[model samples]
Target: LDRLFARHEALRSVFVAPQAKPRVEILPPDAGLPVSEHDLRQRADTEAALSDLCHEEERTPFDLARGPLIRGRLVRMSDEEHVFLLTQHHIISDGWSMGVLVRELGSLYRAFVAGQDDPLPPLAVQYPDYAAWQRQWLSGERLQKQAQYWREALSGVPSMLALPTDRARPAQQSFAGASVPVVIDVDLTRDLKRRSRQHGTTLFMTVLAAWAAVLSRLSGQNDLVIGVPSANRGRREIEELIGFFVNTLALRVDLSGEPSVSELLERTRRTTLAAQEHQDLPFEQVVEIVRPPRALDHTPLFQVMLAWENHAGPSFDLPGLSVEAADGLDQVK
Candidate 1:
């Protein structure tokens, strides 16, 4: 516990600053920034944003003690357009915390553009608070129940995911991959929502089931495994807080054709609810619970991802400000 906190700033900080949102003043997009000058390609825009954010803030002795930790950046891309990109360490921000970060950034940006003060609320809690709560909750009899379910559910399941990889396994550990992109149309997306409503399950569960069916068809295997990021935000106090309150959970789904979509959803619904109920347990602990041998060549217990959508968070407005998804931002990879 001390080691993990020592490595992550948000873990040590009692709370995130209410007004810590990063800001960039963009004159216009017409004035092009030379790629050579910045020494960055279009693809490296996100990297530059992260680097800029790290050093932009005043680094105090306390911050130095926290190590080089900064998770956000605002870059002026052009006269009219300024793009902000942030890469928070997994220790600080989880998938759920992305929404919280974006909303606050948006609110702060809009206020800055309008020459108004940002009335951002102070964080009621921090990632450490959530972590402490989780450690206390996921113990003794409660964890035993979770252990029983996991053991039964995963019994006899092979550890390998059988994903196509490029090179043979080397002694040193490293991971690399390229993915094929896929997109779901707006109308079909709406149909998915309707189907989810009909099943009395959430959109998350419904989408996850559809992916399981796809994997079943592709792999020609009855047994399926997927990794889902749990938001871990059921608690009211931490909903508005940022950082890695998110953790990935390995959810094994059976697509042997015994259960229809609705039935499968029901199973998933129960599993998801049960998982959420115990979500305070970090993925680090889960790795211990489900001890499948770790490997370099082979993918872990679960390889496929069943992502629903990106969190847009709140929006910021300049005099002529507007936000739109970049031409290919939503392209699924």
Candidate 2:
């Protein structure tokens, strides 16, 4: 825990706001992380007790300003069984960072258990340094060029998607949402990948093409815009650092002229390529440039979002510790 905290500056960062401009304040590393231990072996229903405990932990929100911003817990279910829970604020970490955290933790824990020196090399740069570089880099003609491209590309787009819903649209939008798991069998998954390759595009672009098609058919709107998150870690310097480097891109897909699947794929490919080129222009800046009409009920550019998570859970090969995914609310958390 000490090694991980010492290495990544973001782990000790807190956001300070209400100023002229908000900024992140990176604090010095603490002696150790805030961790709690619980033993539920004496309980009659250990599984249920553990589930409740995890749910409670997740619901407890973090204070961004006065924060370690991360917490950990160890639960003992039996003499041989245990579960380690680690939680962090979304501001401090992302999918890439999580992978780094787990991998580093495993490496550090292994060396500690064996009573050896830390094997990992020091980080080249921290998150704050990257932030400084970003502010300096994205300015002047470079920022304006990207901003102009987005304004022209998104001109005259429909204010909102006319998605048909079972219930009438509420005056004030509530973000109460639910997830329905759809199983795509292996054969279908394989075919999708194969088709993506044939189209000279990625799996994400292909899936995005399908989504745009579905939304167009349902909403009866030929022109559609959907938001997709990009890791924004193209630069080699910040790729390994833990920070909020993820950015959203408003992808506009035109389904006019009743194009076939192949034609749609081509359109999607082009749109993705263009977005990738101009992705450095932050989403907030893009909104300012486009000046899309805003409403209290909804967002300006895109309502629905698609996040392509190409990362899987980290592997923990520690002795006597079995790590597996939990079910239901635990999985959601």
Candidate 3:
């Protein structure tokens, strides 16, 4: 815990408001982070008790202005079974940051149990330093070049997609959504992987191509755009840092001419590569340049979002602990 606190400056960040533009104030390292413990072994229904505890924690929101944005707890279900829950605000962390945290925590725990020194090396640069460099670099000519590209690429594109929904469209849309799990059979998964390898593209691009086809068939719209989150961690210095380095890219995939699956995959691959070339341009700047027509009932540019989880938390083989990934909804809201 001490090492993690000292390593990542964003963990201690607090948002300072009341100014024209909000700024982050990184506080000094504290003694230790707050962690609660619960003993559910005494309860008659341990599974129900664990679920209630997690729901309570999820319902509790963090105060951005206050300190200790991250919270954790340890729940004991039995003498040999336990669960650890950690929560943090999205402003301070991201999917990649969570992977870093889990890997580092496992390393730190193993070292502490063995009574050894910390093995992690010093970071090349912190989050604040990256912010400073970004502000200085992304401006003037560079910003204008990327902005012009986006303007031309998204010219005359439809602002909203007509996805078929069961409920009627409301005056103002509500973000309340649900997740339905879709499982792909083993044969299909294997074939997708093989096709991706053969095409020299990623599985993500292939899946996205299929999704675009589905949307095209549903709405009868050949030209469409979908929003995707890019890791935007192009710099080697901030690759391992714990911060919000992700950016959204408006990927415009064309499915006209009744192209075959392979042809669509090729088209999607080219589109993704082109967008990735200019991904440094912030999404806000793109929105300003393109000036997509906004609607009160739906989002601008693209309503559907597709995210690819390229980073997975490291595996741990600690002495008495069985580590497994947790399942959750993948909605943006």
Residues 1-333 of candidate 1 have per-residue lDDT tens digits of 122223223533422344775322212223222111222335446555634544453232223223233322345555555544433335455666555555555666666777887557656665566667777888899878777666566666667555444655566556545579878899998998999899888888888787777777767776867888766677788777656666667777776666887888887787777766655556666667778777765556676676545565344343466765444332100
Better of 2 and 3 by TM-score: 2
| lDDT score, candidate 3, position 259 | 94
**C-alpha TM-score for every candidate:** 0.67, 0.93, 0.91
Runs off by more than 4 Å, candidate 2: 18-21, 329-333
RMSD of each: 9.9, 2.1, 2.9
Error of 2 at 270 (Å): 0.8
Clashes of 3: 0
Q: Which has the better TM-score: candidate 1, or candidate 3?
A: 3
Ranking by TM-score: 2, 3, 1
Between candidates 1 and 2, the one scoring higher on TM-score is 2
Model 1, 9: alpha-carbon shift in Å?
7.1
Candidate 2, run of 10 with poorest lDDT: 324-333
Per-residue lDDT of candidate 3, residues 64-183 (tens digit): 877678777788989987787878888888888877887787888888789998978888899999999998898899878888889988898897898888978887888888779899
